[model samples]
Target chain A: MPEPLPDEGPPSDLVSDVFARDCTSRSAFEDVTAKWASLTLLALHEGGYRFNALRRRVEGVSEKMLSQTLQALERDGFLTREVVTAIPPRVEYALTPLGQRVAGRLRALADLLEEAAPEVERAREEHPGRAR
Target chain B: MPEPLPDEGPPSDLVSDVFARDCTSRSAFEDVTAKWASLTLLALHEGGYRFNALRRRVEGVSEKMLSQTLQALERDGFLTREVVTAIPPRVEYALTPLGQRVAGRLRALADLLEEAAPEVERAREEHPGRAR
Candidate 1:
């Protein structure tokens, strides 16, 4: 058998382990890049919005998933949520500056992806073996 | 209670649903950013590596998770795994050209993240409320 790979799992006590070996960065990347998360972050980063406005801006997102995504992002400190104690209890969500920074990076990635997506499609069409 | 966010879920028959809502993208993001996956992809993207070489390059990853990530990436058509019939069964892993493209985007993101990480830290330190 071949030799085993080095094993540096995430530090158990570090919250940022998500970015570390065994934590959730993998998952986080998946999350942040998702259609809704990306669009939502983009929308919010453009300007703070209330919950419904976010839904409208994102086009297609379920209440459960959006709530879940927002909660996760909030937990990760990517966005901030402020609940206004009103008769109807209004809540506003916006990117933290940290979130804004990440969103900027993600937006750049998205732009690049969008530009390359057509080429990727052509490549896949030309060489089926290159893509699934 | 406030009106809930809209409930647009994933399309039932879409393959790239990972990039859509209500699919594995959230989970996938969580996975890709996970320490091993990122490093592994980075290491592999730099060149190519065998299973053992990848293990060493990534630092810390369990055999199972690595296998899972490889399989997932392969299914998504990111990396290609080649098995050369040999004593003890030798397998090599390399990024597909498509993978190379994605990795380039990811690397750009990683670089941006690395640069912004310090700024984020300083911001958090300056304003405790901004971070978790």
Candidate 2:
């Protein structure tokens, strides 16, 4: 008898290719790297936090945007949203293992940017036309 | 004189903080990670490319979008633009040292996502309500 068919797997050709115009990976890349998403992931990297605490730590995210950002990250498997029964029905957000990995890498990038901030500012000064 | 007043450095407090809502680095982070910008940086990471070639390589970017993205990257000191004196005044774009550093990190994140694509798709399948 023929060997049992392999269980369901992502299509053999389903390689994530951001270079491809129609690749779904492009959307994944965007979801992961969007401004708020990156900040949210970094914020959660430290530890789980209640929604309001997360909002405060993330600095500028409004209530609606934070809610949407967390939901999107959770949907992408980068985070988990756990609701605990209590007086206020507390909600905590934390990174999944996958999210931790991404967040680690993002932190490295963020560190590099911080270290190079002085240089970047100088570049802006030199190119006044591009300064925001 | 006392150390010549340390010759014009970025303000001591001018740190790049993506977590800060009002931080200018927030703008820089956005410029770096925007969809087309990320893809464009990855495309140029391989090597320099002419205007039309770059537009093609980045896959889905419109001509105007590519131009604007390239300008933003150039202004950020992450890349440079050169206009060759030719019959058609050929233009080229390439990553600067700073850009190379960023591209390297971004590439790692991109690779991680590609490797995790199977899992992410699985998550979407399990959470049909969130599937886009």
Candidate 3:
């Protein structure tokens, strides 16, 4: 009877409000912020990578997880996956311009967290429940 | 006898490199980027909120998820929880200076996404898999 509901909320012209939970931006936000997705985006920001190489760059991500994350990022227009034809076909992933902008913000966040890691560790030590 | 293993990897004095699988900053980076944690931090950035208020502000967060997120943020020194004695005891949550700084970066990210939402929507529509 109705077009399949996309996730949640009534479709609105304004899809930019993430705090609303019903907005499409919220779904996009979740896609971007998903742990593996964020890391994959960051890894690709360095340059294009073939699938296995990208997975290696992210360290702990499994093949299945990295595949799914790349698919999702590609769907959201954050990246492009190209099939390079050679002796053997290879799939390479790279950030689109939009993705590069998004990765820049993520990089800033990562830089802050890296610099603050020691302070965070001190706080972890003082947490009431972390006595062990 | 040996000490307990954390979520993963070996302990290191250098905790700031998130790109390294063993660095503790990756764990902290995961903590900050987790969906609910990022939203909760942003909500608190506007001002403090009682637990219920925060749950409401975050839109769809379940009580249990909010509690866990708050606890983690508190442990990381990103926020504080205080009990106010009144007619009924109430707990309030607010970002610490550290959390404020983190939230500023997150806010910048959010702003970029919000502004870029239209283009992302266009990309989503044109994605090869979206022919449905």
Number of the predicted model whose DockQ against the real structure is largest: 2
Per-residue lDDT of candidate 1, residues B58-113 (tens digit):
65678887887777666555677889899988899999876776677677656555
Task: Give the alpha carbon lDDT tens digit for every residue of B21-84 in model 2.
Answer: 6665666777888768988999889999999999889887899999888888888899998889
**Comparing 1 and 2 on TM-score, the stronger one:** 2
- Model 3, B67-129: lDDT tens digits are 989998898889999999998999999999989999999888888888888888789898878
TM-scores for all predictions: 0.58, 0.88, 0.87
lDDT of 1 by residue, A29-99 (tens): 54566546766776776889999888876657888879877876776567888998999999999898778
lDDT at position B1, candidate 1: 95
Interface RMSD to the true structure, each candidate? 6.6, 1.6, 1.0
Residue pairs with backbone atoms closer than 3 Å in model 2 (clashes): none
Residue runs of model 1 more than 4 Å from their true location after superposition: A1-46, A55-77, A82-89, A111-132, B1-39, B85-89, B122-132
**CAPRI tier for the interface of model 2:** medium
Candidate 1 docking quality: incorrect, acceptable, medium or high: incorrect
Encode model 2's per-residue lDDT on A4-31: one tens digit a residue. Answer: 7578864486567877656656667888
Of 1 and 2, the candidate ranking higher by DockQ: 2
Question: For residue A24, what is the lDDT in candidate 2?
Answer: 54
User: Among the candidates, what TM-score does chain A have in each?
Assistant: 0.70, 0.86, 0.86
Better of 1 and 3 by DockQ: 3
